[model samples]
Target: MPVTTRTVEYPADGLTMVGHLALPAGADRRPAVLIGPEGPGLNDFQRRRADALAELGYVALAFDINGGRWFSDPEEMLAYVMPLLADPDRMREIGHAALDVLRAEPRTDQDRIAAIGYGTGGAIALELGRDGVDLRAIGTINAVTTGRPGEAAHIRCPVWAAVGSEDPIMPPAQREAFTAEMQEAGVDWRLVVYGGAQHAFHHPTVDHTVLPGVAYHARHAERAWHDVVGLLDECLPVVSPA
Candidate 1:
């Protein structure tokens, strides 16, 4: 069987949002994986990841965070993403819009859905889990910003977060806060910190990054992706071809 891809555009928050959908070559409904990219929005890296997941028989959607726009400048990206991070409601709106698109697809098995996000997109995935979106697994990398204690109580799925030991954006204290919040919420959660890696370690392309705290580490990136796939397999295993 082969993998296939398509473009899905939808109206969101008065802006035309775009996403890349990857479908496995099968007739059976597959477990869906929603990918939220870094603050730079969806790009080739995220789309490639989606396609890889689809090759493993998961229907994957790489959704946009900034109306299909990406920023090469760190200040500009933060200026756009910081406000959304501060507003949990807005993040949930963006996430739910993407979720709706994934669930509407014929190949997606709505009952078994997982989300993986990087940087700002990771926060959006976490926000969706906090809003009780009924996801099976939530995997985040370099974006372990904790939600309000009360809001975290709504998360019913398992969460797996990975970060670099030296990443300033999500330092040790922030990671502790996120773990504590997840513990208090009684959510099944796991966190991994890789040594010698920086923020956005999973990013393969360095040209898109221009931040002081962000760098790409190939080894850690591969390990983090494997860990995320393991989480999804444990919580939302896809059916094999018949």
Candidate 2:
């Protein structure tokens, strides 16, 4: 099915967030998935993911947490995202605001919502799960854990997380710790580590030259994307289009 796209604006912590919303053509209501960006704000990567989700008969919203801004450099992006990460409440607020926007869509099934995020965006999605948002499933790629002890226990939905096995930023130890915490919390979760992959493994634009520490692995990216889609399909089962 063809995808219809629109720009939406909503209030978020006194700032107006402008996001891109994509839905499958036709008027049938469908499960919605909120797609969050890696850092700074909305970008082509997140937009593409939203469009892909729409093709799968979902109403997907790519949220702009940084008010529609983008940074080509990693340092600049970190400068913007760091402060937000420091404040747990702000992170939760941003996720909640995005979730609200996704739910408010006329063609979205509010009760059957899911969220997927990458990097910092992934962390935000995890925060939403930790806050007990009514999401059916949550998926995170190259996500950063809350680090704070026992944070995983609060998550109520099933989670699917993927990270590059060779990623220096999110190393095997961290992944192990996160898995341990999830197990302790008794949360339904799956952790996948892609061998030889590095940070931001799903971003097509990412290259070793531009971001010295990051390398995008196409194979792992494709596999991880399918895994995420499968998880959503299982948890948020879409109604057949009439």
Candidate 3:
């Protein structure tokens, strides 16, 4: 199926967020997926993911966290994202705004949507699950931070998280804590640790170093993507019409 792409502007967190929407061919409703960007905000990388999902017959929306801007400076990006991480309510608000945009689309199957995010975007997706949103599934990469006490109990769907074993930001202790929270909450969750990979291993290589411990691992990136697709296939499978 051919894929179509467009830019959508929506209000969120006191800024006009610019999201990239990709639609699969045909007017019939399809399962929608939310694509969240890394800490640096929405860029060509995430937009391409949306397009790829569309090509696979899904309605995908790559949402923005830094409104319409993309930050190449790690310090500048963290200065903005760090505060939001502390405030779960604010992150949920941003996720909900994008969800609203996605739900409003005529081609979306409201009840069969899933959320997949990377880096900071991954945290947003997890927050949405903690907020008791109706999601078919939640998948994230490299944002394994634990949520507020008892909040994981609110997650009503299966959760999948992935991280590089050598990711300093999401060390063994942090991953253990996150898994403990999910287990205690009785939520269905799974975590995959890619050995010998560093933080942001799923991201493509950049000209300059974005942050310490952040590097791209081509092999691990592909494997992680395959696993995420498997998660969606199991939880939100799209059946073809006869």
Candidate 4:
């Protein structure tokens, strides 16, 4: 079946967010996924991932983070995204806005929604889990961060996270802390550290020259995608429409 794509513009907080939605050609309801891009915001990379998920018979929504704008420079992207990460409430609001958009689609099986995010977008997906939104699976790449320890208890789904072993953005110490938090919260969680891969290893289009701490590894990217899709298949299985 051919996958269809469209732009979905909606209001998030005070910003007018522009998200990309992809739906598989089918009449049956299917599990939905929300894709969140890194601090630079939504781009071709995330949009393509959404389309891929849709081709697998899922409704995928790649939502905006920075008001439909993406920054090329690292300093500029950090300057804009750092503040948003500091405030959990704001993250929750953004996630809620995107979640509502995913749920509103007629083909979405609301009961089996999942969220996968990269960098800051991963953090937003975690916020939705912490807010007790009842997601089936939560997947993050190079974006796992420990929230308030108590908040993890509200996450009612299995989580799959991956990061490059040499990723400066999320080092061993950070991963350890996040692991401790997840263990304490008793959430079903899995973590993978790809050897020698750098931050944003899953993003093939990301330019490491412009972004100092990030680099792309095609092999690891493929492995990470397989892991995430496996998580979704385990948590939110969809029967093909004959």
**How well is each residue in 1-242 modelled by candidate 2, as lDDT tens digits?**
47989888987856888898999978988999989888757877788889999988899999888876777777887788888877777888988998888888899986788988998788889888887788899899988575456777788899899998888888878898888888898989999889999998988854323555688799999999999889998999888865
User: What digit string (tens of lDDT, one per residue) describes model 3 on residues 94-122?
Assistant: 99999999999999999999999998899
Error of 4 at 134 (Å): 0.6
lDDT of 4 by residue, 1-242 (tens): 68999999999968999999999997789999999999988999999999999988899999999898989888898898899999899999999999999999999997999999999999999999998999999999988788975999999999999999999989999999999889999999999999999999998765534576688899999999999889888998878976
Worst window of 10 by summed lDDT in candidate 2:
204-213
Q: Please tell me which predicted candidate would have the highest TM-score against the true structure.
A: 3
lDDT of residue 234 for candidate 4: 96
Model 1: pairs clashing at backbone N, Cα or C within 3 Å: none
Q: What TM-score would you give candidate 4 relative to the actual structure?
A: 0.97
lDDT of the structure predicted as candidate 1: 0.90
Q: Could you tell me the C-alpha RMSD of candidate 4 in Å?
A: 1.2
Model 1 RMSD in Å is: 1.1
lDDT (CA) per prediction: 0.90, 0.85, 0.94, 0.92
- Quality of model 4 by C-alpha lDDT: 0.92
Decoy 1 TM-score against native: 0.97
- Cα deviation at 121, candidate 4, in Å, is 0.9
